[model samples]
Target: MSEGNGPTEGQDKVQSSAPPNAVWPLRDKEGNVTVPFAYGTIAFWQGKRAQEYQTHKWHVYVRGANNEDLTPLIERVIFQLHPSFNNPTRVIDTAPFHVCELGWGEFEITIRIFFHDGPEQGLEIKHMLKLFPRVGEPSQKKPVVSERHDEFVFNAPNEGLLQRIGMCNTRMPNGGPAWATIEPFFSPLNEHEELLRIQAAQRRVQAEITLVKEELENEEQILSFLQDEVKKLEPSIVKKPPGT
Candidate 1:
């Protein structure tokens, strides 16, 4: 898949009645719950003299967009680290969900997110850890930041989940959830802001496609003109046959 075109975000739907053993709240009119989130790593390079294996310190985290607390919607997060590490599997069950360590090598980290309600299956995701700067980019003291934005869609959600989602989206001073009172690293996503970002990316890709098409058309025109000129000269360029 192209960049920003990875797997679809998590979508949980309830199709049939719950099992006899399980009890869930009545379905709400909202019908769908969307929780926007971002996951990736932030890494800082140690000085050149540091050990090769410990040249970079990094933290891998899954956070609600703009650093909003995810405790309301997420029950816990399971992170599978590289096998080289001792006890490679780690579980976090609170806000500021993250793991911190020192390492130089890069690898793909597996993350599984469990929701607070039913749908026993957890959403699985993979992220590639990057520590070094790309070619042609200047190196600096600032940490390298790489993250992807996505949202979870819960369809036909029960009343309990709808209430939790409501708490997450509501603003403070209006009986919002406790987490809303906390400060975020960045401004919260405004209405339609996610749509606007997607549209902007699409526009950039479309512009590049248009330029390529124009170049192809120009080359085709040049080829056609050369073929016509060659046809015009053929008669004179061809010597008459001896019999003719």
Candidate 2:
């Protein structure tokens, strides 16, 4: 919502699921397979990211589902930045699902998060791109930034997926979950950190919007007061002679 977890303000429940031989993804005490939650986020930054580039710069970042760092958990994350971008689709297998490019146009980014041979069905999330001040406008104010959060509920997940989730959350035994390991197999840091960064940037835009609204309200009040004062005056006050 405004400043909370997935499903943004307008949309509710980004995603959920089901399957027969499926068990919940995660587990808690009493050896029960619990439903696992995956958080998805999309963030954008607008400015001159590259000095030599003539066009404006836009930076986009994606946070994996469930706040799980895909760097170590999944095989790769694909991002379809935009049609204008040369070779728009990218396969990322690192810390940041970030892309930097030079352009004045904005489009929707389709992101696919896939896991390696875990038999777990992949997830998809899309975000609309935004750039501050629009095209052909002065960049006097802070760049227009936007961040969205969404989540998926993995219900009745396959056993393999459950094992994958267990391995990710450190519920594994000796080395890790029998299917996977703990050490470098899963990222040490959570992906929510990136989401926090995005939210912080989005807050700047929100603050600016609030300030602009307040200024507009003040101006309207001043104008209304002036109108009232004018009405209080006699029409003859500013009336001029027939010929001057």
Best by lDDT: 1
> Which digits, one per residue and each the tens of the lDDT, describe model 2 over residues 175-224?
21211211222222334675687589899999999999999999999999
> Which pairs of residues have clashing backbones in candidate 1?
none
TM-score of each: 0.60, 0.43
Deviation in Å, model 1, residue 170 alpha carbon = 8.0
Off by over 4 Å in 2: 1-55, 64-68, 117-121, 133-141, 167-244
lDDT tens digits, residue span 1-244, model 1? 0011111122232221111211122233575556677788776677778766777766677876645446777889998888776566879786656776677688899999998873679799999988877754424456676777777878877777776765554222221222221122223445387789878999999999999999999999999999999999988896878999
TM-score of 2: 0.43
For every model shown, the clashing-pair count is 0, 2
